[model samples]
Target: MSHYHYSADQLSQKQAYKFLTGAIAPRPIAWISTHNLETRVTNLAPFSFFTILSSRIPLVMLSVNRRPDGTPKDTARNLLAAQETKNETARTAGVIHIVTPELLSAMNQTAASLSFTDSELELLPDELQLLQEKDAPLAVENAKIRFNVRPFQHQLLTDRSDLPMTDIFYLEVTDFYFDETVFDAKREYILTEKLAPVARLAGNDYSHLGLLETLRRPD
Candidate 1:
């Protein structure tokens, strides 16, 4: 019957972040990749604040938070953002990938902070990366699951000078790419253990698939 409670308005930035991120343990991560047509360079980054907005229409959300210095990260900057278009079809597109255990090393490598002009994919060691020429710009070649996404709607969280700005993008999933090994075509369900998708914990922690049990609701 005893627990600590703090008011949101009273908490400091560090305290607020620590509580939010810590309480929301093991969140699914979105390993996003976008191409800057102008620079002819690719950008890849990971966001833990990701989830499905709608499944019937196929939409997913990825939130990109500004850095400690209050600057937008490369992915947010490159997200068909600079050249926004009115038409959804004409809008710039990118890929949202699901990280598996095998791709963990490469995924972590892409999370490094780099300049807008610099490409993060190139920073990975040869042993952890294997990108194909034709499929190179689309998505991470090593990831088992991916969503070809186009920006359906975008909103800026807030721009207060004292607080970090975050960009909220709801992407329409045009299609899904699943490696045959992890997909069950007949049943149309993924093999969770085989994929062993990675989840983000607070700070530098990550988690993989564990024991699973299905519970059914009474009809």
Candidate 2:
């Protein structure tokens, strides 16, 4: 057996990001949709640095990196603004849609670089519908599973130099929407085969759910 190791401190930011993304296999994608309160413009983007933090409170975490200009990304900014504002109705809430293989193309479209005034939803195919939820941001119409989430907390990650690098958000799920085709109401389990989730790999690579396996825990 052979092993190669590199110190993170020695690697450039770009190199470190490349290596980390390559080494981390099959990361789930969070197709986040947020709305700007002032512009009334909707923003959609994909991030793989996402995971469920606490099931009890239905909390999910999303980590976003700052832009090269040292500014918060649109999604992070919108979420933060939503949290600070004490409006009778949430003016900047969002929805996190679960990405599936079928929606990969549409999801990728949302990732394109666009002006803050522009909307990525317009680039999507006509078949892909965007539906408005009363007070929340628009939701992907046919997404098999989606979470109506609002910003719960925001944390800024900084380097030793005290330079902010990443923004981490803890979101609270207010509601859940699941498609009947993928979820079993009586069994309370998702039909994995039907869901066909796509996972992010290194670079432009992505993977589909491969061989399914199960391991039972000892009672």
lDDT of each: 0.78, 0.88
Error of 1 at 10 (Å): 2.0
lDDT of 2: 0.88
- Across 172-204, the per-residue lDDT of candidate 2 in tens digits comes to 888888899999999999999899989999889
Candidate 1 structure lDDT: 0.78
Best by lDDT: 2
The parts of candidate 2 lying over 4 Å away from their true place are 86-92
Residue 38's lDDT within candidate 1 is 78
Going through the candidates in order, what is the number of backbone clashes in each? 0, 0
Which stretches in model 1 have alpha-carbon errors above 4 Å?
Answer: 68-70, 80-83, 87-92, 128-136, 159-164
Of candidate 1, the 10-residue stretch with the lowest lDDT total is: 129-138
